[model samples]
Structure formats: structure tokens, C-alpha cells
Target: MQPSPLAAPDASWYDIPGVRLVGAIAGALFLVAAIRAMFGRK
Candidate 1:
């Protein structure tokens, strides 16, 4: 059976250029924050 419109699978990450780029930037920022929390200057 086919999925309903509201229940359809999401597009592949690379399919949306803008969202992909934004997600990458956000992920990088979070990674930097985590590293800083672990070893940041007091």
C-alpha cells in the first residue's frame, strides 16, 4: 500500500541543498561547542 501524503518518507539529505548546508553548519557548531566544553580555557 502507498503511504499517505503526510506520512511519506522524507527526501534524502543531499536532495535539498539549502537544508543540507544549514544542517552541516549547525552540526559543526554543536561539535565545536562540545569540544570547548571538554577542553576550553577556564
Candidate 2:
């Protein structure tokens, strides 16, 4: 079933720069962890 018109997803509720920075940091952390695991380092 589809969402109602009043319940449609909205993209304007977020602070763009804040969201981007948080996402970037999380991505970087994930990459670093992956690299460390692959290299068998603590």
C-alpha cells in the first residue's frame, strides 16, 4: 500500500549541512574500521 498524500516522505525536515557532516564522519569511521580489520590490526 502507498502512503497517504499527507504522509508522503519529506526531505526538507533535515538540516542539510549537519546531515552531510554526520554522514561523512560515519562513512569515514566505517572505512577506517574496515581497513583495520582487513589488515588484522587492533
Candidate 3:
């Protein structure tokens, strides 16, 4: 059976270019923050 249009179970929002770009930026920011926190002080 085919899935209904309203039931898009395979919808990958992150696969979109805009979402990927935003996600990449967010990931980079979070990674920088984590690195700073890990070695910000002795």
C-alpha cells in the first residue's frame, strides 16, 4: 500500500539545503562553545 500525502513519514526536513545550512551553523556554534568550555580554564 502507498502512503497518503498527509502521512509523509519519510519527510526529511533536515535534508533540505536551508535546514542543512542552519543545522551546520548551529552545530559549529555548539562545537565552539563546547571546546571553549572544555579548555577555557585550568
Candidate 4:
């Protein structure tokens, strides 16, 4: 069986110094875009 991708999330993600914060910002932007799309398509 194939292993799960998120089995060790903390260990693999954002090992670099400033990458975690950038990831957070990107996530927030994606969420905002998703919400806007959801609301605007009505």
C-alpha cells in the first residue's frame, strides 16, 4: 500500500527559515479566493 502523504506533516514541511510564514500567507490567500468564489457564484 502507498503511504499517506501527510503522515509526518510537521517533519517535512517548511524546514527553511522563512518558508513557514510564506506558506501561511499563501494558504490564507487561497482560502480568501475560495470564499470569494463561493459567494460570488451565487
Q: Which candidate is the best by TM-score?
A: 3
In candidate 4, what are the lDDT values of residues 4-34, reduced to their tens digit?
9858646655676678999889999999999
Give the candidates in order of lDDT, highest first.
Answer: 3, 1, 4, 2
- Screening candidate 3 with a backbone cut-off below 3 angstroms (N, C-alpha, C), the clashing residue pairs are none
The whole-model lDDT of each prediction reads 0.85, 0.79, 0.87, 0.82
Residue pairs with colliding backbones in model 1 are none
lDDT of 2 by residue, 1-42 (tens): 878887537656355568877888999999999988999675
Q: How many residue pairs clash in each candidate?
A: 0, 0, 0, 0
lDDT of 3 at 6: 85
Counting only residues 3 or more apart in sequence or on different chains, how many pairs clash (N, Cα, C under 3 Å) in candidate 1?
A: 0
Regions more than 4 Å wrong, model 4: 1-13
| Candidate 3: Cα lDDT at 18 | 95
RMSD of 3: 3.6
Query: Which 10-residue window of candidate 3 scores lowest in summed lDDT?
Result: 7-16
Residue 9 lDDT in candidate 2: 73
lDDT of 1 by residue, 1-42 (tens): 878876538777678679888998999999999999999968
> In model 2, which runs have C-alpha deviations exceeding 4 angstroms?
1-10, 13-15
- The 10-residue segment of model 4 with minimum total lDDT is 8-17
Off by over 4 Å in 1: 1-14
